[model samples]
Target: MRVENLHCSKRINPLVNFLIVALILSPSLTIILIPISFLLIMVYNVIRFKLLEPSVTRDTHEKFLQFIGGEPYYMDLDTYGKKGGTYADAVAIDAHNLYVLHEDNAVEIPWSMVRSWTIQAPGADRVVGVGMTAAMTAASHNIEAAAKAHEASGLFVFVADVNHPKWQFRTADTTILRKWNEILTQRNEGLLAA
Candidate 1:
């Protein structure tokens, strides 16, 4: 399929958009706040790196397990897209559905709605590896630290369906997409018993 022909639309993260709007509406306060926030961020990064371990990626599943319950599922970083920018949005997946939580609303999509899917990873991801346990598994064999670092890199997930328009989402890494596909697509046509 002609991906080059497809538009690489920019994804404006909604929370960022809201904050920008709020700041614009209050320019006097924004000017004052921006400098303070920048200083704080710079200080935090400096001190955190010097004195503390870097933060780990929160397991997207465990974070929202209260909202979704099932064994052995896939929870992508909630960034949905096969290409383009990937933001760390609140996205989760279970055995039979994909759950996306937004600022004012949530979306739950059945597996039936996903007719097909594709994963888009950059050259870097392929060099490190791009799926499931294998990615992590590869990490330990001399490339452990490098692979782990690569694991948090960006990738996109695309879903195509007859009933709905084609959609794309971003993921923090390719493993999320692979794991999601493995769990969500294991069973073919039968309805998930829920």
Candidate 2:
């Protein structure tokens, strides 16, 4: 389809609309259009930066990690039509043992819904030399470090708290997934116990 036809009818270029409105208003002695035009431009720029631009940086993922409170995660391409906006992919949590999140939407992972995700780096070098063994070792170490207080019982239960405000719920192993399911089941049973 043509570029002009790519957008929905409800959407139109802000600059074009602003110019048209300003021209029409100025002739009718409506100086308010000047400020309106400026406001529209500012809003357009903000939307462009936050929702449209997809340029990746060395710190893109890092920034996202900080947004989610520095948690480990995996990437998933999100092409879910209008909800995905302009980008073709997204970085999602590895809810499963595999690096893949399994479902296209993060909400489908039996946890809370995902607000948004983005890749920090779009460079090829990021994944080139990264070996799975090294990655797993580092992951295990991070888990151990993060789970220090909980490891005292010999059973390290990694729970995916999908409802947590900062991060999406995910674990490094399927055992944790099962454990979480069981925990939820038991908690639900308690509710039904009454």
Q: Evaluated with TM-score, which candidate comes out highest?
A: 1
lDDT of 2 by residue, 34-116 (tens): 54554564465446545444432223334334433345433333221122222222233333221121111122222233223
How high is each candidate's TM-score? 0.37, 0.21
- Cα lDDT, all candidates: 0.43, 0.33
In the range 1-194, model 1's lDDT, one tens digit per residue, is 11111121224356654565565466577545754544453454345333321111233334344455554344544422212222234455566676653321234567566556555544332235466445444443434343344444332234454443444444446676676555445544444343
Lowest-lDDT window of 10 residues in candidate 2? 1-10
How does model 1 fare in lDDT?
Answer: 0.43
- lDDT minimum window of 10 residues, candidate 1: 1-10
Best by lDDT: 1
Error of 1 at 171 (Å): 2.4
Which residue pairs clash in candidate 2? 60-120, 61-120, 78-89
How large is the C-alpha RMSD of every model relative to the true structure? 13.8, 20.4
